[model samples]
Target chain A: MKQFSKTLLSIGTALAILGSAAAVQAETIKIALAGPSTGPVAQYGDMQKIGVMAAIDDINKAGGVNGMQLEGVIYDDACDPKQAVAVANKIVNDGITHVVGHLCSSSTEPAADVYEEEGVLMITAASTSPSITEKGHQLIFRTIGLDSLQGSMAADYIANTVKPKTLAIIHDKQQYGEGLAQTVKDGLEAKGISAVMFEGVTPGDKDFSALIAKLKKENVDFVYYGGYHPELGLILRQSAEKSFNAQFMGPEGIVNADLAKIAGDATEGVLATAPKSFDQNPENKARVEAITAKGEDPSGPFVFTAYAAVQVMSDAIKAVGDTDPAKLADYIRKNEFDTSIGKVTYDEKGDLTESTFLVYSLHKDGSKTPAAQ
Target chain B: MSEASLYFLQQLINGLTIGSTYALIAIGYTMVYGIIGMINFAHGEIYMIGSYISFIVIAGLLGMGMVALPVILVIALVIAVFTASTYGWAVERVAYRPLRGSNRLIPLISAIGMSIFLQNYVVLAQGSRDVALAPQISGSWTFGDPQLFEVSLSYMQLLIWVVTVVCMTALTLFISRSRMGRACRACSEDQGMTNLLGIDTNRTIAMTFVIGAALAAVAGLLLGLYYGVVNPFVGFIAGLKAFTAAVLGGIGSIPGAMLGGLILGVTEALTSAYFPSEYKDVVSFGLLILILLFRPSGLLGKPEVEKV
Candidate 1:
């Protein structure tokens, strides 16, 4: 029995040596960043790229993963679910142990299943659906808070701050939009706040009068939409033209610079809830300065999360003392890493321990500034 | 029921104004296809270019802050129409003309290539960020019994509707009455026979493209004013919808295109209201399937007997 155990131990060591010989080789570690590189929501992909690349670059410079330089490969899934799964297959096939992103909720959600099955850890900086981590993929982690948190926070703010008696809710009916809208609506209902009207608008719509007119008659004090900037901008501009005059509110999707352009002054006084704004925090001053010194904007809250994703991955690899996927994922769950946002510890479900949100009001002169907490 | 009535009426007006713009865009598709028997796939990009041209012109004007509302609309319309005509001509000469007599698939492929190239070129020229188009005619008039159900008529909407209708009527007159119109119709009947006759088929084809492009430009300008934002890639989905509009109205027929545009617009508005707005295009394609399955020739289209 002792001789058989000795033979088994030797086979394990041999296999370990062979595995090391194949993928990591004790000299180099590889990670991947995946997102939409083209198509409509490419800006979201751009943010993913910027976050992952910045993090990867910073890590390699700072003595990456136990004396081995961390290398990165980018895969463009164009934010489609089908393409995202294909990217997942490639990531597994290519033997990347760590990943920083799969941008959109649809893309990230499906890929999470694959990542879990393969034991490849994904720490996405921005996929904001509640159902994403609901399947309980321990290998999957997100730096950005889920839509449920943001949505409930938005609803709380609307109920407490705005105190609008008759609220109206609209959504683009996307997973992000519709899901967030429902979360907020439920939160509002829990607070005894009732929306007079609730509906959804299509993206790329040129007209929103029918929806705006509903808000008009109801005399709604606030209109909360869960969608990206495009339809939100149109709703604002057209609502003002039609003189609906109800205050507009939304999730982080409406906080983009494009909102100010599309809706112009009509976007004034409009409120949107997002993750804690990086610009408003004096604590993040040096981080902002650091990013800008490189001639890039780090004022966007998610940018820090991207930087943190790279930090966490590198730290995990270092903790494990190797680049094996299983070991790296185990290290990730067990370790609490410092990030640009704050110290983050993941639950067994791979969600952050604590998350917060902020609200910003759009200004007339093409600016959006944070609202008082 | 009064609340629902008012809502329906308001949706109808909004749909009509939107429909008018679609009608103009559909005319361009129908006109070009009638003459060439090929879908001008780049027609949507032509519209997008028109919007950008008007945006640049209007931005410059707004920077000066001199032009009145009427003057701004006029100049934007004229600039969009004129600039788009050049794009139309260029598209024919560069992308379509050489491959004209080849298999239909070849021209379709070339048209798609041109569409993508122009979209990317615009994106490169102007960043992907949507530029704010603050069209100044935001003036409105509200009407209701107690004024509780207020419906507004913005100057921008009025201008879009006016330009769309005027362009549509002018185009109808041009096709029905003018010499070039006859040449267009003759070419649609038989390109070879018309070529044998005194018509300058190349010039006529170019003109068809120019006129179609011009209409598409007006549509773009109208959308920019209505939506109050312009992006380089905005033409993609709108163009696909307009092509669908052209097909639904009977691709090569003028009045049919107009009807198709109205139907698509109204259907979209109502669908957005009643169904999931994100799936609004589902209705368009669904209607398309139903129409094709039942009629095959479309709502207003005549049966073209198979040659074989």
Candidate 2:
């Protein structure tokens, strides 16, 4: 009887051991997808969610990275700087080693410091304030081109192509908007184009007749807006209403399909500069298809950047065996990966070394078509 | 002759337009406060809901081939006002009625709870993203020359201001002359006494909410038309500003709300454009602080006297 009991116990222990071994073999890679999943800019944040979800779907279909299925855990930051740090703390507490975003520049900048201290590797797909990386963190990298790239391009285009004798510069006054405005101002001034007026407009405002009146008084030939589409739309709409008929220009934030809708027909003939990867780029065909397959339109500027962020981070994780954030971050800083946008290498300052910008014009139909080559 | 003077004038006009919106919304705040003595923090969410409701109805109608501008606007306005009015009644029933005659603080807290609940509910229902509002009308009428000084006015902005003025005038007449309007004034003056005098205070309170909510809906429609965008949480700050306007004018006074709204709107706009964009909010809250410190009753508001 004793011998039989011992045999049964041994069999039970073996079964338990086998179950534990299989469970360990089926382990998944946990990647945190933190951003404003619920807030005003959730439109932009949704892009991050869609990009991460699609990347995970594709990676898992290909058996994931290093035989582990990539799992995305999302957090809502609501684009608030204080809340972003809280979300970062929550991400680290949950043992999430790799993080994907906090969409806005303000939230992303502060959150980057938290990830750096925790040794968690984070790549911002949308945050583009140059000052974010100017402080220098190895873990921080953005997929899209910076405002400086677009800012200089815009200023140069205005100075050389448009050649307005008088120019007015207006900003939304956020870090991304104001900083980019400064960059463009420098570029325009260097080209010997003296601006007629410089102003800053608030986001989500309803009127701009005062700014128009000022422009009218200055006899400003052109307007340069360093802001998002919301204010730019209102400015244009108001400009049309009050009879201020000068040409308008803005940075990538306002250079979207939605801007036309915001300003309606008032936006026609307005020029805005963004990345060169819009329609007519043959390199992005497969990537666009990949995005479309996930039931999302990659028409927005950040989708490719977001998708690339996921790809780069996963590659870095694979290159560095363990999940130590510091090691993973080091691996990311050292590597170069080919993306839908093209081969991207992050410099020590975590800024993309290779970048391009394009200028687009609003057509009469309110469609954004690339400026004639 | 100087550039700065022209700039200031332009800024002043911008502020006035925005202030008009604030005044319209402030009517809701002041009305609710007068009738119930409860600060409905959720009033902002009501404004947001009004915008979304209009968005859905308009977008749905546009989807079904009703693209005519005037027709769409009229139908959307009717639907938004009706739905928003219904929403106001529902809010009173759920958030306000339960706390009726309770400590003012209790009702205020519930108002905050209701505000959060509504914002989250909209987030779940509408998805947490700013819905793009495609305006039906485009182009502005240009009066000045393009090269030297061109002054233009778009159809949408003109429409918004005209609609606001007309609605506000009608609201003022309705409150002063209508049978229900007199009862509302009585209730605000003395709810217990009005109840003793054979008025169904409950129904009157609900009606005030409905009317206030409809006014907010008009403002929401105007916002959607002007900016061509709407999101679920858009009402919060606007509601606060409108409330400020109401207090600035005189909490229980209808005309005061109008004046307050215009003041807040114009102040916000001018600050944003002239000083610095970041200072816009600073200007708004700073004025609010100044008003509180100097004249707590507001620009046109009268100090309330507790009745025996």
Candidate 3:
């Protein structure tokens, strides 16, 4: 009887400890860092991860939000839509109420539907498709500008600055790539400049010889590609090999160090329209230093945007004094928050009231200079 | 040449270059099926591992400030081939050997499982992002009038042709004359009979796998250099296309795979040149269906004869 009593007492103590641990876990707010951690474009996901982690670290160091700690859980979607939907379901199952990613627009759109239905707040830091916000979901938000904004900026630069005789547009046929291509085409059409050919190329295809041959035959002077770096890198290199000599330009998706590595010297003079370099902002010196001090790159276009996403979510949670999604959503939509990307204000559609995209000439060394307009 | 002719010629050259690499990958599939009568779905992963090995070797050499391109190429190729052959042997020993003589679907499923395992393994080891290699081969030879249009062949494309032709010629000679090659043919014809003749059929089958893997590694190295980029998922598509080529040439036939690869490559190139680029895949698959509808045995494939 004495031994039985002792065993019961130990079991009670163990249960108490586990219960306390569970309580402590409940006290913290969990934000799911959902994005492509493994795929062709996972490098972009790394940019998002670095930004979110840095922001969470800084927030915890400042005594957390509403005196409760912030926790981040990472989920890999591989920038694939089906995988993103599965990830969204898993995040919901895991009871994470806040999310900071789904970087590719294709992945973000499908995942956003689940978040909206579940009343989970999601702020995509990199996806730029305008159609994402066109549905006007209350919980769907993004720190980055829409593709419509970037596409028009690119079209305007092409029309007003580097006027060419003939233009061609190609896309990878995904939601993000195809939508951005259409936006650019529409923007150019509005400016009375129509592309000679608007074609979609299958992603993951290595050879672009036929495409190059057709481009050469069409006598296009400027080629606008809407895809990520891998495909565009091959296209550029193959075009160089064929001596096609057409001026190649693409959106921010193709702007990365990998592009130069793949295309070698052919990457010179490639034009891209991307979000302004927020790390270069003098006002964010300390924030930039904090990120760099941890040996993370702060120059990626998605970095500050992802940081601002976490910041806005934490600020709203603190201001609302709770983790209620409806209340936080209402509070975030109505107010402005000063973030690493300068002041951020969301409109009714969960898009920033103002966003700036600039045209830059990318160099072979992976540096960018503002292209003359 | 007229602009039209030049465009046609350019597409043909491009197709031939891509097709040659496809042929290299297809030989692995055809030879394995010919001997074992089971599709080694994991063969694609072997090719992927080969590419990763080459990338690591080249990147390491370059990082160590080794600027000798030829030396780097030779070293990477040798290591990739040797490592990939080892993987091929292991895969056969582990995945297929245990399931031999079971339901045929059993080995196919096991092969698929192995493929998934290898892909995830690579993803965990080397990461999932595309790794780029600096192009060692550059420049091209142009023909026709530069003012209208030019048909150009890149040095990388030329290397692909030379390497593919040499590999194919060597393989042909080996199969026709070498003792191991004769053993492989005997095992493929009748494994039990070859075993009764005091020849180790298992070793012959294993040798066939090794040869196929070596060829695949060569393709992996060549294609990796030509594209200047490689990712974990590259093998999936390339493998599917190569499988298609193997089937189109009649699975289990060596020369048929080569012809099928060239045909498929040229068809894709011409379709993309004339129609929308996205439709190229559709047209190529459609051609495959049409051909199969007429000749279910596939072009150059001998009709299977069953003995009751």
Top candidate on TM-score is 3
> Where does model 1 exceed 4 Å of error?
A1-147, A192-198, A282-353, B1-4, B273-280, B291-294, B305-308
Q: Which candidate order results from sorting by DockQ in descending order?
A: 3, 1, 2
DockQ of each: 0.44, 0.34, 0.62
The per-residue C-alpha lDDT of model 3 at residue A208 equals 90
Task: Write model 2 residue lDDT over B1-308, tens digit each, in one string.
Answer: 34444455546656776777787788898888878776778888888888887788888888998868778888888999999899889988988888888788987887788899999999998887567666566776644344444444567657778888998888778888998989999998889999999999999999999989998999888877776677766787688778878877778778888887888778876765556455767877788789878987777766777767
User: Which stretches in model 2 have alpha-carbon errors above 4 Å?
Assistant: A1-147, A266-269, A278-354, A362-373, B1-15, B60-71, B137-162, B266-288, B306-308
**For residue A323, what is the lDDT in candidate 1?**
65
| lDDT, residue B44, model 1 | 87
- The model with the greatest lDDT is 3
lDDT of 1 by residue, A1-373 (tens): 9999999999998798558657765567777889888999887777666666676677777776677877677889998999999999998988776888888888999998999998888988888777888886778888877667888888888888889878888998788899889998999999998887667776776677767765666778788899898888888888878877888888878877778778877878889886776545676676567667888766655677777888887877777776676777677778888776778888777788777466887787757677866
Question: How far is B54's C-alpha from truth in model 1 (Å)?
Answer: 1.2
Which scores better on lDDT, 2 or 3?
3
* Candidate rank order under TM-score: 3, 1, 2
Q: Write the per-residue lDDT of candidate 3 for residues B1-308, one digit (tens) a residue.
A: 68888889989999999899999999999999999888889888889989989999999999999999999999999999999999999888988888878999998999999999999999998899888887778888988888888889889999999999999999999998999889988988889899999999878888888898999999999998888888898889999999999999998899999999999999999999999898999999999999899988789888888956
TM-scores, chain B, all models: 0.95, 0.94, 0.99
Proportion of true inter-chain contacts also present in candidate 2: 0.61
The number of the candidate with the highest DockQ is: 3
| lDDT per residue (tens digit) for residues A23-86 in model 3 | 8795689999999899999999999999999899999999999999898889999999999999
Better of 1 and 3 by TM-score: 3
